[model samples]
Target: MDGRRPEWRACVLSGAVFAVCMAGTTLPTPLYPLYQDKFGFSELTVTVVYALYAFAVIGVLLLVGNASDAVGRRPVLLCGLGLAALSAVCFLCATGLGWLYAGRLLSGLSAGLFTGAATAYVMELAPEGGASRATFVATAANMGGLGCGPLLSGLLAQYAAWPLYLPFITHIALVAVSAAVLLRLAETVRERQPLRTVRPQRPALPPQVRAVFGPAATASFVGFALFGVFTSVSPAFLTESLHVDDHAVSGLIVALAFFSSTAGQLAVGRVGVRHSLPLGCAGLLAGLALLAGALRWDQMSLLIASALVGGVGQGLAFRGALADVAAASPGHRRAAVISTLFVVAYTGISVPVIGVGLLTGPIGLEGAGLVFIGCMAALVVTAAVYLLRRPEPARV
Candidate 1:
C-alpha cells in the first residue's frame, strides 16, 4: 500500500491526459457549420468528412490496436498526443477542405492509438484490487473527454476572439501540458518489445466466444449508431428544422448526450453486467422513440430528451457489452476481441451517419433522421428480445 500512491496518482493524471486527447477529435463538431459557410460544402460533404475520422480509426485499430502491449503504453500514448497536436496544427492552418480532412484523419489516428492503450494503461496504474474503480475512471475519461470537446470549442468559439483558431490553439496548449505529464509516468509493460515486431491481427471471432459477443455487439451497434447520428447531424437538425443556429447551443446539445452516457455507464456497476444489455436496449428503444418524436414534431425539447435518455442507454449498453465480452474472452485474445467489438461500434457510427447525409438531399434532414430513428429502434428492440430469450450465464 505504501508504494501504491504514486501509481494511483499516475492513473488519475493519465485519465486526464486521455480526456484532453480525445477532446481534440470532436472540437470541430460545433464548427462544422462555420466550415460549411466558409468552404460552401453540402451536408453530405460534412458527413463524409466526419466518416473520414471513423475510417482512420478503424484502419489503425485493425493494423495496430495492440501495439502498446508490444512496445509500451507511454510511447504509444505519447505518439497519440503528438498526432493530436499535429491535428490541431492542421486545423489551425486550415485553408481548405483538404486541411480539415487531414486534421480529422490525424485526430482519428490519435484516438485509435489511445483507445485501447490508454484504457489498459489507466487500469495498470491503479492500486491493486481496484480494477472496477479503475475501469470506471477509464470509461468516464473516454466519454467525458468526448463530451468536453464540443463544449470547450463551443464556448470558446462563442465567446473568444478567434472562433475557429482558438479552439485548436487551446487544444495544442493542453496537449503540451499532457505530454509533459505523461513523460513523468512510469511504463507498465515489463517485457516490452520493439514497434517493428508489431503485426496486424485479423479481427475474427472464435467459435466459443460467439454467444457472449452476439448480444453485446448488437447493443453496442445500436448505441453507437444513435451517437453517430446525434454527433454527426444533430446540429443540422437544430439549425435547419428548429431554427436554432447558435454554435454553442448545438455543441451543448451534442455534449448532453455524451454526458448522459457517462451517467449511464456509472449506473452499470449497480445494474450488474447481466442486466445491462437488456436494460440498455430498453433505454435505447425509448431514446429512439424520443428521437422519432423530435423529428416528427420538430420539437427542441424532444431532441434534448432524446440526447439525455438515448445517451444513457448507449452508455449502459456499450460499457456492459465491453465488460461482458472482456470477461468471456481468453486472456491471450482479449485485446483482439475488444478491437473487433470497437470496429463494430465504430462502423455503427460511420455507416449510419453517412446514410443520414446521403438521404438528407432526397428526403430532407427531418425525414432522413426519422428513417434513421426507425432503423435504430428496430435494431435495439431485436437486441433486447435476444437478450431476454438467452439470459447471460450466471457468474460465480
Candidate 2:
C-alpha cells in the first residue's frame, strides 16, 4: 500500500490487525495434544497435521505471493483476515482429523497472504518521520502476535471454561474487529493493477547475491527449524516426558521463544550487523545444547533456557542475514532474492518438522529432537565459520 496520507493511528491499527491474523496461525500450538486425543492419532499424525499448514503456506507463497501488490493491499489483507476467520470456524466445529487438517491449511493461506502484504501495508501507512518506529511496530506485531497466540489460548484453555472452543471464538471476534479497522484505513496502492496481471514470477538471485545467500539463508533455515520443533512437538514432550501438563505453562514456554526473538532482533542495533550473525550462531548452539540437556534430563528449566537462548539466536542471525543479503542484492532483484530467502527458511520449518514426525515412531520424541538439534547445529556452525572467515563488509 502506497498512497495519500492517513493518520499514523491507522498504521498502528493496521499493525494490530496484522498481529491478529498472525496470532491465528499459531493459536493451536498448545492445543495440539488435545486434538491428538480427540482424533485418536499418534504424535506422528499431529506433526503431519501441523506440517500441512507449513506446506500450504509454501504453496500460497509460490502461487499468489505477490497478488497484493497488483490488486491492492486492503483487498488482499481483508481476504486473508476472512480466511483466518474461516480457519477458526473450522477449529470450532472440528469433528475429526479432516477438520484439523482443513483448519491448518486455511490458517497457512491466511498467513502467506498477510506476511508480505501486511508488512508493506504497515510501512505505507506510516506518517513522515515515523518510518523507523513504524518498522518496529510492524516487526514486533508479527513476532509479538505469534508469541501472544499461545499465551492467550493457553490461559483461556487452562483457566477458562471450554478449552478448545473459546480460543477460536475470541479470535473470530478479533478478526471481525480487525476487518472493520482495516476498512477505515486508506488505500495504499495509488496505481494498483489488475489481479490478472499478477503472475508467479520465478525468483532469481544474481551471482553476487548467491555468495551471500548461502550462509545467510542457512542462519534463517536453522532458526526457523528450531522454532518448528518447539511449536509442533515440545508440548508433547513437556507433558509426556518432562511431567509438565499445564496448558498455560506449555503456552508460556512456547511463547517465550518468540518473545525472546524480539529481544534478540532489537539487540542487533547495538551488537552491530557483522557481529549479529556469528553471535547468533553462538546463541543457537547454546540453545541446542540446552535443548539436548532438557531432553536427556527431562528438566523443565533446561527446556525454558533453550527457548530463550534459541530465540535470541534466531532473531540475531535471521535479521542480520536479511540485512546483509539485502545489501548485496542488486536493487532490481532485491525483493525477489529476499522472497527466495524466506521460502527456504520457511521450508526449514516444514521439512525438518515432518522428519521429526517420521522419526518419532521409530526412535522417540527426545531422540528425534536430538537428531534435529544435531543437524541444525551443524548448519549453524558452518554458517558461523563462513561469517568469521569472511565478514560482510560494512559498506555492503
Candidate 3:
C-alpha cells in the first residue's frame, strides 16, 4: 500500500492534466450561440466553425499521433498544453470572425495532441494490476472535464462579468497550472527516440486488432456523432424553439449528456465489455428516439431525457470499445491505434454535424436535427447488430 500510494497519486494527477486539456476543447461549446449573435453568423457557419476543430484534430492525429511513443509522452503533452494556452489566448483576443476560426483550429491541435498521448500516459502511470481502475480514471477525466466545460462557462457567462472574456481567461489560468503539474510527473516511455524519427502514422490496425477495431470504431463513431450534434447545435435549439435563452440552462443541458456519459462508463465495469457495446448501442437507440420525440413535439423534458439516456449509451460503448482496442494493441503502437479510433470518432463528429448545418437553412433546426438523428440511429443499429453477432473478447 505504501509504494502504491505514490503511483496512484501520479495516476490521478496525470488524469487531472488530461481533464484540464479536454475542458479547454469544450469551453467554447456554450459560448457558440453568443458568438453567433455577436457576429451575426448563420447556423451553418456555427456548425462549420465547430467542425473546424474536429478537422484539425483529425489532421493532427493522422500526421503525428504517435509522437509521444517515440520522443516520450511529456514533450507531446507539454506541446499540447502550450497549444491549449495559445488557443485560449486567441479566444481572449477575438476581434472578429477570423479569431474564432483560429482559436478553434488551435484548440483542435491541443486536443489532438492530448487525446491519445494523455490517455496512454494516465494508464501507464498506474501501478501494476491497476489497469481497470486506471482505465476508469482516464475515461472519467475525459468525460467529466468535457461536461464541466459548458457548465463552467455557462454559469460565468450568465452571471459573471465579461461572459466571453472571463471563460477563456479562466481557461488560460487552468492551462498554466496543468502544465506545471505535467512537468513534475515522470515520463512513462523508457525507450525514447528523436522527434525526427516520429513519422506520421497511417490509420491501420494490426492483424490482432482488426476484429475488435471494426465494432469498436463503429460504436465510437456513433457515440461521438451523437455528441457532435448535441454540443454543436443544442444551444440554438434551446434558444430558438424552446424559447430557453438562459445560458446556464443551455450549458447544464449540454453538460448532462457528458455527465451521464461518465455515469455510463462506470456501468461498464459491472456490465462487462462483452455486453457493454451492444447495450450501449441500445441506449443510443433509445436516446435517439427521445431526441426525435423532443424535436417532433418540441418538449424540453424529452430533450433533457435524450441527453441523459444518450450520454449513458455513449459512455458504455466508448469505454468498452476503447478497452478492447487498447488490450489488443501492441504497446509500441498503442497511441497510434488509439488515435486511429479517435480519427474515426472525430469524423463522426465533423461530417454529420456539417451535414446538419447544411440542412438547417432549408429545413430549419428541428428538421435538420431530426434528419441527423435518423442517420445516427441507423448507424448505431447497424453497429448493435454487428456487436451482438460478433461480441469482442471480454478482456476487461
RMSD of 2: 3.0
Query: Candidate 2 residues 1-396, lDDT tens each?
Result: 254245577888999999999899889999988887888999988888888988887777777776776788899999999999999999999999999999999998998888767766786688876655565566668777888999899999999999999999999999999999999988887778888888786656777877777887889899889989999999999989977779999999999998988788888878977898899999999999999999988999999999999999988887777767766766444434556776777798899999999999999988999999899999999989998898555333
The C-alpha TM-scores of every prediction are 0.96, 0.92, 0.98
Using alpha carbons, what is the TM-score of model 2? 0.92
The residue ranges of model 2 lying beyond 4 angstroms of the native Cα positions read 1-8, 127-134, 206-211, 325-337, 391-396
lDDT of 1 by residue, 145-207 (tens): 988999999898888899999999999999999999999998888888988989997788766
Candidate 3 — what's its lDDT? 0.92
Q: Name the lDDT value of residue 288 in candidate 3.
A: 92
Q: In candidate 3, which residue pairs get closer than 3 Å at backbone N, Cα or C atoms, i.e. clash?
A: none
Q: Give candidate 3's error at residue 90 in angstroms.
A: 0.9
Candidate 3 per-residue lDDT, tens place, 1-396, comes to: 998999999999999999999888888888988898888999899899999999999999999999999999999999999999999999998888999999999999999998999999999999999987888888889888889899999999999999999999999999999999999999999999999997877898888888899989999998999999999999999988899889999889989999999999999999998899999999999999999999999999999999999999999999998889989889998899999999999999999999999999999988998899999999999999999998446332
Evaluate residue 26 in candidate 3 and report its C-alpha lDDT on the 0 to 100 scale.
85
TM-score of predicted model 3? 0.98
* Top candidate, metric TM-score: 3
Off by over 4 Å in 3: 391-396
Best by lDDT: 3
